[model samples]
Target: MLYQVALPLIPQVGGGTARTLVNYLGTPEAVFSAPKDRLAKIPRIGEVLVRSILANKEAALRQAEEVILRAEKEEVQLLYYTNTAYPDRLRDLPDAPLLLYYKGTANLNAPKVISIVGTRKSTEYGRVVTEQLVQDLVKHNALVVSGLAYGIDIISHRAALKEGLSTIGVMANSLETIYPTVHTRDAERMLQQGGLLSEFPFGTKPDAPRFPSRNRIIAGMADCTIVVESTSKGGSLISADIAHSYDREVMAVPGPITSETSQGCNQLIKSLKAVPYTRAKDLEELLNWDKALAPASLPKPVPALDLSGFPAEQQQVLRVLQQAGPTHIDVLSRHTQFTMGQLSSVLFTLEMSGLVKGMPGKLYGLV
Candidate 1:
C-alpha cells in the first residue's frame, strides 16, 4: 500500500487536525490530490490538516517510496491488513496493527505456530525449561514465536536456531531500529534464520508504552502462548490475558513453589484460566496437530537428555545439588556422607564445569 494512503492513518502523526481530514477526504491521497474548496468542505480539516497534508504529502510519499525500496533490498515482505499475507489470527483483533514488515523462511500462517514468552529477568531454571520446551515444539515443526525481549526470548531464539527451527521475533520498535540494542546481532541473525516482525514505522524507538501494545501482537500471532516463567505482574501475563481474550490457549510451566519467579504461572493456573504445561505433549495434544499438520504430520521429538560434555563426577555433584537446594557444605558432606575435602573438591569442579553456580557469600547451587 502507498504511504499516501498509509501515513495519514497514523493516529498521532498528524495530530488533532488530521483525524478530521481523514474523516472527510477518506484518505490522505484524496486530500493531497483534492482542490482547496473540496478540502474546505470537510468538517474540521479545512486549514490545518489540508496544509499539513499538502506540505507533508510529497515528503511522506518519498519516505514511503524509500521504505518500499528498503523492504525490497532487505527481502522484507510488507503485509497490510487487506493483503492476503496478513495473519488471519490478527485480522479480527480490535486494534490490530495497520501493517507488518517481515523477512523469514516460513509462511506467516504456519499451522503449528506457538508463542514462547516469559520474564525479562529469567532464572537458570526458567532458561532450561524454556529452551527444553522450544526444542520439543520446534522438533514437531512448530514455529516458535516471541517478543524478542531479553532473557527467555533470546534463549528460545538461539535454541530454535541451534535446532534449525523457524523462529519469529516481534519487535516493539520499527524495522529500521531495534530495541534493547543488545539483541541487534540476534535480530539480524533472525532475519536470516527466520524473521523480525514489527508494526511500528521505520525508525520508531522502543518507547515504554509501546511494549504492552506490542504484547498484543505476540499474543494475536500465535495459536497458543506458553509462559516459561514470570513475576506476579509482568508482560507474559498480559500476553496470556490477551490470548484468552482472543480465544487462544494459554499454558504455563510450573516452577518451584517457593520461587518468586514462579508466582505468575501459579496465579494463572490458580485462576483456572490456563493449564499447567508439564510436557510438549500437553501442548500438541490440545493443538490437534493431526489436523493442523495434516498430511505433513510433525515428527515427535526424541525425549532424551544431552550430556555430551558432562563428567561423571560433575554429573554426580549435579545430582546431589538437585536433590537438595542451598545445601550447606557440612550438610552436603553428611548427606552424601563424603568427606569435607571430597565435597569441597566436588563443588569446585562443578562450579568450573558450569553445572553449578556460586551464589552470594559462597553459597553454591546447581546452575
Candidate 2:
C-alpha cells in the first residue's frame, strides 16, 4: 500500500505514467526497484522520469507513510486504484488517481451514480431546476455526486439528502477540511448519509490548480454528468468536457438565453455535445435506468452469434463477451488478448449490429 500510494508522488510519475509503469513492472515497488536503464526503455518513459524516480524514491515513500498514518488516525479509507472497492468507472480512466482518500458511508461503487455540477453563482431558477431533478432521481435510488461547493453544488447535495439519497462530495483539498468553511456543517450532515472523498492528502490546501483534477472525479465516477447551469467558462463546463472525453453521457439544463449562467448549457446543446436536460425522467430515460432497476437473475448464456463472415478479431471478441457475462472492457481485452484499439473496433462493430450493449463504466454485455 505504501508503494502504491507513494509511487505517483514521484516528480515525473503522473497518473498515466504510473499506470504504465505498473502495467510494465507489475507493481509500484517493482517500478521503483527496477534498473533505471530498463525503466527508461519503456515507451514514453524517458531518462528524466527514471532519474526523477530514483532521486525522489525515499522522499515519496516517507510522504506516503505519513499520509497513510494520517488517514488511519482520521478513520479515512485509502482506496488504491487496483482495489475492488475503488469505483470501477474511475478505474477505467487512463488518468485516474493512484489512490483516493474517502470518508463516507455511501458505497463508491453504487449501482447508480449521477454527477451534478453548475455555476457557483447559481440563480434561483437553477436551484429550483436542480432540486426538482434531484427529487425525481430519488425514485431511482441514485447516488448524487458533486464538488460540495456553494450554489448548485450545495443545492444538489441538500436536495439529495432531503430525498434520502446518498450524496458524495468530491473535494479538491484534503478530507481534513472543507473549503468554503460556511458549508462545513452541511458537509458534516452529509456524513450521516454520504461521505467526503479526495485524492489530495492532509495538509494540502485547496489551491487553484487542484479543482480541474477534482472535477475529473466528479465527471468520471458517474455514468453521466448533468450541468444544471454554467457560464461560457467555469468548472462545470470543464467537468462536462471531461465526461464527454471519457465517453460518459453528458447533460445540461436549458436556461433562459438572457442569463449568462445558461450560456454554457445552451452552447453545449447547440454544439450537440450534450443532451438537453429538462427533468429527472429525461435523464433516467437517457441512461436506461429502468434496465438497471430490473431484478437481478442468473447470468444467461450468450446468445448464438452468426459470425461466419465477420473478421477473426471480432469473432474472438464476441466469444469472450459470450462467456464473460457483462465484463469490463479491460477484462475483455485481457480475455480476448486484444489491444484496446482492437477491442474498441470490435465492440463498436458489434454494437452497430445490435449484437451487444455498452453499459456505463465501460461494461459490455450481449444483447
Candidate 3:
C-alpha cells in the first residue's frame, strides 16, 4: 500500500509514467528498488525521470506513510488502479489517475453510472429539467455522478438524494475539504448515501487547473455523461468532451435558444458531439437498460462462435462483444489494450470472416 501511494508522489512522475513503471517493473516497490541503469533502459523513462525516482524514493515513501495515517484517521479508502475497489469504468482509461481517495458506501462499480453536469449558474428551467431527469432515471437504477459544484451539479446531487439514489460527487480538491463550503451539508449527506471521490490527496486545493482533471474522472467513471445546461464554455462541456473521447455516450438537453445557459448544450448537439437528451427512455434505449432489467428467461442466449480457429486477439474481441453486446471501437481498444491500428486490423479480419458486424458510429457487435 505504501509503494502504491508513493509511486505518484515522486517528482515529475505523472499517472502515465507511474503506470508504465508498474507495468515494466511488476510492482510499485520494484519500481523504486530498480537500479537507475535498469530504469533508464525502459522506453520513455528518460534520464531525468530515472534520477528523480531514485532520489525521491525515500521522500515519497515518507509522504505516503503520512498520507496513509491521515487516510486511516479519516476512514478514507485509497483506491489504487489495480485494486478491486477501483472503478472498472476508469481502469482502462489511459490518462486515469493511478490512485484515488474515496469515501462512501455506494458501489463505485455500480451497474449503471450516469454523470449529470452543467453550468454552475443554472436557471429555473435547468433545475426543473435536471430534477425531472433524475427522477425519471430512478427506475433505471442509475448511479449519479457530478462535480459537486454550484447550480446543476449540486442540483443533480440533491435530486438524486431525494429520489433515493446513490450519487457520487467527484471533487477537484482532496476529501478533507469541500469547495464552495455552502454545499458542505449536502456533501456530508452524500457520505451516508453515495460518497465523495478524488484523485488528489490531503491538503490539495481546488485550483482552476485541477477542475478539468476532476472533470475527466466524472466523465470516465460513468457509462454516459449528460449536460443539463451550460454556456459556450464551462466544466460541463469539458466533461462531455472527455466522455466523448472515451467513446462513452454523451447527452445534452435542449433548451431555449435565447438562454445563455443553453448555448453550450445546443452547440454540442449541433456539432453532433452529443445526442439530444429528451427523456429517461432515451438513456434506457441507448444503454439497453430496460433489456438488462428484463427477466432473465425473456432473453435468448447468444449462439457460441467458433473461436478456436481465430487468433487470440480476435477471440478476445469476440468474447467482449458477446458479453457487452455492441461496443464502440475506442472502447474495444481500451478493453483489449490494443492500439487503434491493431484493433482496426483485427476487426476487419473478423468482419471478413463473418464473425462480427460493424455498425454505424464505429460500433461492432458479434453476428
Task: Using TM-score, give the best candidate's number.
Answer: 3
lDDT of 2 by residue, 174-207 (tens): 9988998999988998888999999887888999
Error of 2 at 262 (Å): 0.4
Please report how far candidate 1 places residue 202 from its true position, in Å: 1.4
Alpha-carbon error at 40 in model 2, in Å?
A: 1.7
Q: Which candidate number would show the highest lDDT if scored against the true structure?
A: 3
| Candidate 1: tens digits of C-alpha lDDT, residues 1-367 | 6753356343344323443554467864665687877876777554665566556667777777878877788777888655677776675555666568877766677756788899999999998998788778765777888988988888898888888888889988887777778888888788777788887767778898888888898998887898888899978899999988865789988888899889999999999878899987777666655334457665554333345567665565566667665543434554565655677788887778676786531245666
Question: Between candidates 2 and 3, which one is better according to TM-score?
Answer: 3
What's the TM-score of every candidate structure? Answer: 0.68, 0.89, 0.92
Ranking by lDDT: 3, 2, 1
lDDT of 3 by residue, 1-367 (tens): 9999999999888788889999999999999889988999988899989889989999999999999999999999999998889998898788989999999999999878899999999999999999999998898778999989999999999999999999999999999999989999999999999999999989899999999999999999998899999999866999999999987899999999999999999999999999999987787777767665677874578777777887899988988898898887767887898987799899999899888898654578987
lDDT of 2 at 169: 97
List the candidates ranked by TM-score, beginning with the highest: 3, 2, 1
Which residue ranges in model 3 land beyond 4 Å of their true spot?
A: 293-303, 319-341, 358-365
